[model samples]
Target: MTEAAFSIADIPIYGRILLAPMDGISDAPFRCITRRLGSAYTVSEFINTHDFSKLRHYQIARLAFQETERPFGFQLLDNDAGRMAEVGARLYELFKPDFFDINMGCCAPRVTSRGAGACMMRNLDLIRDSFRRLGQAVPVPLTGKMRLGWDETDLNYRAVAEAVVAEGARLVALHGRTNKMKYGGKARWEPIRELKQALPVPVIGNGDVNNLADARRLFEETGCDGIMIGRAAMANPWIFAGLDRDEVPIAEVFALARYQVRAMHAFYPGEKGLVAFRKFIKAYLAPCGLPYEKIVQLMKVTELEGLLEMLADIEAELGGQGQSRFGWEGLANPFEKEQKA
Candidate 1:
């Protein structure tokens, strides 16, 4: 498939580069920052369909978005078609998101234990029924994010995509690996190319796109309508903006990290907000290659004022250095720890 072979549906996917919905990471603050930095589209962290019904505070926080985050979808995960449809209608009335996405690629044990996420691919009947129910319940465009299948032997990417499209899905994002791969090994792009050829709807390819060259390769090779980025975006928030780490100054890194902290504080407030922001510290400072001990020190400073003080102290400590210390290569992805294992 050539770049010319790729085409988008009538739906408003402003740009081809999209921010993938990630649990615990794609919060209101991060989405808003990424949108401003240049991510064409952003998805709310996947919301459990049942939880959407109650509109809990944390769920509400997840759904909250700035006006700048236009042309984004709210991803939903569920096993029961009837309940998904009911909640879809309720969410439409309350949030009115540009689109609603069924999550079929999440590999988390808790989610799969509920027979949702990537587990949905194992049941063709459920995939078809879900699209049907969601289409009937919500008037907005429908989309889905899915892995190739549950495992190597049951590679049902095409079958599941066909079922959803036939049932009324406007778009499909295919993460090249199967559920068994989790975050391990390389993502095969050939399946994505084949899925693009097979489906009438636009197909977005995901997995392992860590830089601009990677984004171009995904498009040039698979001819996917767009590319969705996950973990890589965490390390470099300006990734979609075409900004490389070499171009970013140490001061700007601190500024961006501080801005994210401010947004988290504004949205959540008090101790809860500060604690939630802790997860981002490493990713924001990834380019600087902060030492593990320094990172641990920074992570332990939970309070906003204390965190700022720590950041200043670290900057002063590295003031005369010509280049940053190196060790990021060995850092564990705190976000994907459970899935990677």
Candidate 2:
């Protein structure tokens, strides 16, 4: 086996690159694809304890995962410690995730308006109480993902981090931007460095890591235990495999795109699968240089067969079948290479 780069509690995470839990984007299909590609572990899309406690189907569906996606986690977002602990125990009974992650970094208006997400950073006592309750409620280790603070004026990540860890958090992932920044400017890495220096457990640094080179730089700069890739993975899941978008051969890209669509189709029901898949089609086709009109035509395709046909035509046009020219056979598992090395 490849030596683990880090561990969340006792569960070994064999790779440093992880797929960030993105709502709508990191569904089971996509998470599994990234996992197969080489992501260290998978995290579910944010599960609002409010909805999940009510037995909502959508939130329940978000908790679904393949056994192969082990070391998986369910990320909970809410303001109430009691409710989060209750839901955490219930989910543990049902899904048995490797760990539970508290969502303290989301800056979305809908999330923040509820005094959840990054707003949690404004109150250190709440952070302490939540982790204390969560640690008592679930048998598994607890983790957290958060920003620098609520805003520039209140950069209290250190206090919050110390509070959570004191209560029971075993690992922390820091997105190096204030909630007010809302992904507006550059993600500051200095705070990540500080957290790594101060925290006793593993620190995973997030934000602004767009490629393998950037991943290396974040590790060098922060000495973080792991790297979390979010938006960049939407376009290039191969990033987890240590290959950039431009470096991937056209044939492999087409194969993975088709593989993802088929996976999505199987996971979601009926036309909803095709509908949900529309968001990814554009990202997969971005590097193809297809005309705007053709791209629109592909996007407009609602039927699975029609979408597959359109993709085939585009693949033939792009010479995707001519793999010999690129000297590529198939997508090899990068983790296997890592294990051998």
Candidate 3:
């Protein structure tokens, strides 16, 4: 393994590229896959305290992780400072994660409408209070993931970041866009540069990084201590291994896909696992040029054994082990720069 890129609190992060903590998507099975492929560490999906306080089984299950996923974290999302601290402390005793991350970046209406996610940025006092309380409540290091702010007029990420760190946040991951931007428009990298210069903790730059090339640009342009990949990682997990989607061989893709489905089945069990696996089928087969009909056929399968068999058939039909039947032109490669003649 390479030397640590940077440390959060006292924990050393072995790699600079980390899989972003995405709700519904960054589960234990997926985190383990990415971690094995070279992602530095794992962070559980957002554990909404509102749901957790109610003893929601799904919310509690999100915290499940293996020992291999060390330097792991539980990302807590809620508007209540005391509730967040209370849950953070309780969770530490139950799960013993290496750290706890406060979610201040999610812009989903369901999240912000309650003044939780990005809306939390509108209140600096809450940010300070929440972190201060969490610092006191949880024994592990506290961290934060936030946006530029509520919107263009409210770009106060600097103040929000400082407020959290003042209390005890050891690391700050900044997604360059504001809540208003949601996911539209280009993610502003300048603010990430600004935060890197201003913040005392390790700054992980996120947003608009879709591949290894974008990852390189983020590190070069911002001089950030780390990079976080989100949406792009869904289709091309090999990005964690420093390989682009097109660069991955068909055999390797099929093998990983099989592994992921089996793991998901074990994690979720029965048809529940098969249903969850459908979300990823499209992305894993994106490079194959598999017809819409064939893709739909595979997704509609209701059993794990049946689905595995179908995947094997598709892999063989598309060019088994040593060859690829898909067109390279069909796959998007943002890293391929225009040449100047």
Off by over 4 Å in 1: 1-9, 54-58, 316-341
The Cα local distance difference test for each model comes to: 0.79, 0.84, 0.85
TM-score of candidate 1 on Cα atoms, chains taken together: 0.87
Name every residue pair that clashes in candidate 2. none
Clash count, candidate 2? 0
lDDT of 3 by residue, 1-341 (tens): 67788999899998999899988788887888788788998888998988788764543347788787888999999999999988888889988999999999989999899999899999888888889898899888989999999999999999998888888899999999999999999999998999999998999999989888899999999999999999999988889988999898887787777777776776764476678878887887887888899988987999878988998898888876853223222333211231211
TM-score of each: 0.87, 0.93, 0.92
lDDT of 2: 0.84
Query: Compared with the true structure, what per-residue lDDT tens digits does model 1 show for residues 1-341?
Result: 22333333454555688788899898877887778677877788887987666554434576676666767678889998888888888778887887889999999998898889999998889989998988899878899999989999999999899999999898899999999999999999999999989988899999999888899999999988888899988888778778766666676566666667756766774576678777777777765777788888877776878887887777676562334222222322222211110
Scanning candidate 1 in windows of ten residues, the lowest lDDT window is 332-341
Error of 2 at 319 (Å): 0.4
**Higher-TM-score candidate among 1 and 3?**
3
- lDDT, residue 141, model 2: 92
On the 0 to 100 scale, the lDDT of residue 103 in model 3 is: 93
Superposed by TM-score, candidate 2 places the C-alpha of residue 249 at a distance from the truth, in angstroms, of: 0.7
Question: What is the clash count of model 3?
Answer: 0
| Least accurate 10 contiguous residues by lDDT in model 2 | 332-341
